[model samples]
Target: MSSSLSTVLLIARREYLERVRTKGFLIATLLIPAVMGALTWGSATLASRAKTTSHVAVVASDTVFAHDLKQQLGSSAQDAMQVDLVEPTTASRARLDEQLQDKHSTLAGYLWVTSPATAGALPHFTYKARSAGDISTKTALEDAISAVLLRERLSERGLSHAEIDQLTEKVTVDTSASGNTKAAFIAAYTMFFLMYMVIMLYAMNTARSIIEEKTSRVFEVMLATIKPEQMLAGKILGVGGVGLTQVGIWMGAAYAYSTFGIMASGGHVLIGLTQVLYFIAYFLFAFFLYSSIAAALGAMTNSEQELQQLNMFLVMPLAFCMVMVFAIIREPNSRLAEIVSLIPFCSPLLMNFRLSLTQVPAWQVGLSFVLMTLTIAVILWISARIYRVGILMYGKKPSLPEILRWLKYS
Candidate 1:
C-alpha cells in the first residue's frame, strides 16, 4: 500500500480504538436499548392496567332509556365498562357524587341525561367524573348514548328489532389493504429520529476531538508524519466507524426484540434487511458530510466555547429537517416532501423517512445518493484546504475573509 493510504488507515484505526474502548461508548451503546425496552414494557403494562373495568352510573328520568344506555355501554369491548341504571333524581345524583369522592368506592363517575322538553329537541348530557380528563370513557358514553337514541327513534317509527339492528350496524375499515399506515408511521418516526441523533452526535464528536487534539498541540507532532488531509480522513473514518458500530448493535438488539416478540409483535414494520442497508448508507452520507464541516470548524476555532457558538449554524439544517417531519410523514410523496428530500443537506433524513413510509422511485433514490456524493466530495475538498492551514495556526479565531484566504493559500 502507498504510505499515505497506510498512514490514513493507521490513524483511523487509532481513532476508532480510542473511542470504542471508552466507558462512555459502552454505556451509550447499552443504555439506549435498555431505556427503549423499559419504555416499551412500561407503556404495555400501563395500557394493560388501564383496561380495568370502569364502574359508572347512567342517570335518566326514563327507566327504559337508562337501561338501554347501560346495556349499550356493556357491549363495547374496549371500554370494559360496567354500568348502573340510576333514576334521575336530586338525591340519586348526590349519592353518586359521594360515591365518586369516596376513595374505596368503585364508582368512577356518572353520566346524566335530560330528555328534551319539546318534540324534535335534543337531549342534554352532563358527565361528572373523579377525573375530568377521562376522555376515553366520555367518548364511549357518547357513542353508546347515540346508538341508544337511534334505536329509540327507530322503534317509535315501528321498525322491528332485526331491521333496526341491520340499519344501525357499525362498519369497520380494513387498513390491511394499505399495508398498515400506522406501523409505517411508527417505523418511519423511530428510524428518522435515530438517524438524526447519531449523525448529529458523532459528527460533532469529530469536531470536538479535533479541537481537543489541536488545543493540546498534538497535531504539531502528528503533522510531521501525517498530512492534514490524511488526519481529517482518518478522524472521519474512525469516528464514523464507531458510530456505525453502535448503530449496528442497536439494530441487532431491535431485531432480537422483534424476533422474540419482546417488541413490535404481530408483523410490525420495525426491522428488515433492506431498511438496515438504507440506514447504513444514509448514515454514512450524513456523517461524512457533517463531519467534514465539523473538522473544518474545529481546525479554525481555538476553543470548545468558540465551537459551541458556531455549532448552531451547523445544527440549523438538521433542526429544519426535524420541523418538517410531520409534514413529510403526512404526505411522503407530496411535491414539497419530494423537493426537500432531493436537497443534499436534507436528503439523508427526509429520504429515509420517505422510504420507510412509501416506495420511493429508484431514480429519485439513486439521484439523491449521487447528489449527496458530489456534495460530500466538494465539502471534503473545501474543508481539507481550510484544515491544512488552520490546524497549525493557534491564536485568535479567524474571520471569514481569513478563512477564505486559507483556501487560496492551501
Candidate 2:
C-alpha cells in the first residue's frame, strides 16, 4: 500500500485503541455482565426460598378440609411453606372495607374451596387473582381436589385404593421437527442486534469526524495532500478498522468466557469462529456506503446546526430497520422480509434479522453481498465527487440538483 494509505490506517488504529482503552470502556466491559450474573443468582435464590411459606386468608365460610387444603398447598409448594391461616372475623361494612384495603394482608386470595353446598363435583377456586402457574399452581390445586372427590366417590361405590390408582394412567406429548430452530433464533436475532448497534455507532462517528475536519479547515490542507476519494476512503477504512478491532477483541473475550464456562460444566464448546469472516465482509461494505454519505453530507454543511436538518435523511431509515426487528422474528420467511433482506439499503438490518430466524440459502447471502458492494461503490463514487468540490464551497448548503452539478464539475 502507498504511504498515505498506511498513514490513514495508522491513524485509524490509534483512534480505535484510544477508545477501547478508556476507563468508561473498561468499566462497561466488566460491569454489565457482572450485574446480569448477580440478578440471575438473586432471582433463583428468591424463587427457591419463596415456595416454603403459604399465605391463606379464610373468609366467612367454614369447612372440614380447609386446614388440610392449606396444608396440602404448603406441602405441594416444595419449600415446605408454613401456612399463615387468617381466621374469619365479623365487622361493620366500613371496617370490612378498611381491612380489605389494607396492603399488609398476608393473603394469597381467599379460600372458599370448602363451601358445604358447592363442594360436591368440581372444587371452588376463588382468589384475588388468577391461578399462579401452569403446573405447580394450577395443576396442583386441581389434582388435590380431584383426589379428595375421587376418595369420596370410591367410598360411596365401595371401590378400593388399587382401583383408584388404575384409573390415573399416563399421558405425554412427544414432539419432533426437522429444523435448527434454536440456532436460527440465535443467529438471525444476533445479526439484527449486531447490525443495529454497529451501524449506528460507526455512522454517527463518521458524520462527527467529517464535521470536525470540515469545521477545523483540515479538509483544505488534507485535500492538497491527497484526493478527496482517498481521504474519504482512509477515514472510513480507519474508523471501520477500529470498529472491527474492538469487535475482534470482544469476540476473543467472549470465546474465552465461553471456554471457561464449558470446562466448568463439562460440556462441548464451539465459539463460532466462521461467522467472524462474514461479519467483517458485510461490515466493510456497509461502512464504505454509509461513511461516504455522511462525509459528503458533512462537507456540504458549514455548521452543526445545518447538519441537524440533514440528519433525518439518515435517521428515519435506521428507525425503520429497528422496527423490523419484531417483524423479522415473527415471520422470517415472509415476502416482505425476503425483499427487505435483499435490498442494499435495508440489507444490513433485514439480513441480520433473517439470519437470526431462519437458515438462509448460500445464493441469497452471496447475492445480497454482491448487490450491497455494488451499491456502496456507486454511493462512494457519488459521495467522493460531491465532496471534492463541496469542501471548497462555503455557506448555503447545496440542493440535490446543485450538489449533482458540483459532483459533475468536480
Candidate 3:
C-alpha cells in the first residue's frame, strides 16, 4: 500500500512537471491574460470611436420639421449608420454627385423626405445607398423617428410634456426571495463559467494526453513501473493540478487588478473570499470526476475517432445543464432544478449557477456535497476498474456491455 502511494505520487510529480514546464504552458499562461486585456481594450476602443453620419438631401417644404428630424437623428449614428440631411436643391445635387463619385463620401446615402409632416413620424422618402445597413442601425433610426412622431402627436393633442414623459418611461419590477443584489447575480454567473471552463479544460486534456501516450507507446514503458490504477489516478491528478494552476493564475491576476482598480472605481458586486474557497472545492471534485471518465474513454480508443463518439454521453449532460443555467438561477428552489442538481454529474454546474442567484438551504448544500461525494467515489471505482483491464486491451474498442463486464469481472 505504501509502495502504491509512492508510485502514484512519483508519477503525478513527473506528469505535473512535464506539463507545467512546457513552452505551451508558459505561452498559454501569458497569452490568456494578454488576450483578455486586448479584447477588453479593443471593445472599448471600438465603442469610443464616434460614428460618422450620412448626409441626406432634404428637399422639403416644411423646413422646421426637417431641422427637428435632423436634430433628433444625431451625428453619432453616422459612425455606424451615417445619415446626413443636407438641403440639397437641384443645383446642389450636381455638386453632391461629384462628392459621391469619390467613393469616400462620408455620406452613406440621401433620404429625400419630400412631403410635409410633424416631427417623430416617418416621412415618405427615397434613400440611395451602396448597400443596406444592418438591422440594429435600422432599428435605432426607427426608434428615433417613432419618438419624434409620438411627441408631435401628443403635442397636437392636448397632452403636456410631463404626461408624455410619464407615459414614455419604461418600467421594471424587481422580485426576489433573497435581497436582489448585484453580488447575487454575479455569484451565479461566476459559478457557471468557472465550472464549465475548468471541467472542460482538464477533461479534454486528460483524454488528449492518454491518446497521445497510447499512440506514442509511452504508456507501455510507464505501465511497467506503475499499476494501471496508480497511473490513471496520477494522470488525472497531474492534469487537474495543471488546470488548477492556470485557474489560480487567472484568479490572482483578476483579484490584483481589481484591488488596484477599486481605488479608481469600486465594483458593484461583493463576493467574499470564502466563496472562492467553495469554488476551489467544487472545482477539484468536478475535475477529478470528469477527468476519470475522460481518461477511461481515452483508454478505450487507439485513435481520436472512437474517443469522440464515446464523449458525447459526457458532453450531453454538461451541455443540458449549461443550457438551463438561466432557468436554474431563476428557480433554484424549483423541484425540477433541485432534482437535477442532486444528480451527481450535473450538480457541480447546475448548483453553482443556482447558488449565485439564490440562497440555497444549508441542508441542501450539505446534502448535495455528501451525495456528489458518494457518486464521485462510485464513478472513480468504476473508471479505475475499467482502466485496470482496459488500458492494456488493444484492437477494436469494446461495446458498452463488454466495458461493464470488465468493471464487474471481479
lDDT of 3 at 364: 74
C-alpha TM-scores of all predictions: 0.93, 0.73, 0.78
Worst 10 residues of 2 by lDDT: 262-271
Compared with the true structure, all predictions reach lDDT values of: 0.85, 0.63, 0.69
Model 2 lDDT per residue over 275-358, tens place: 445555666666766777777778788887887888776677778877876777787788777877888877777775565345
Superior candidate under lDDT, 1 versus 2: 1
After TM-score superposition, the amount by which residue 74's alpha carbon in candidate 3 deviates from its true location, in angstroms, is 4.0
Stretches of candidate 3 off by over 4 Å are 1-3, 44-59, 75-85, 88-101, 116-122, 125-131, 134-137, 158-194, 214-224, 256-267, 270-279, 329-333
Best by lDDT: 1
In model 1, the runs with Cα more than 4 Å from the true position are 39-52, 259-268
Clash count, candidate 2: 8
Best-first order by lDDT: 1, 3, 2
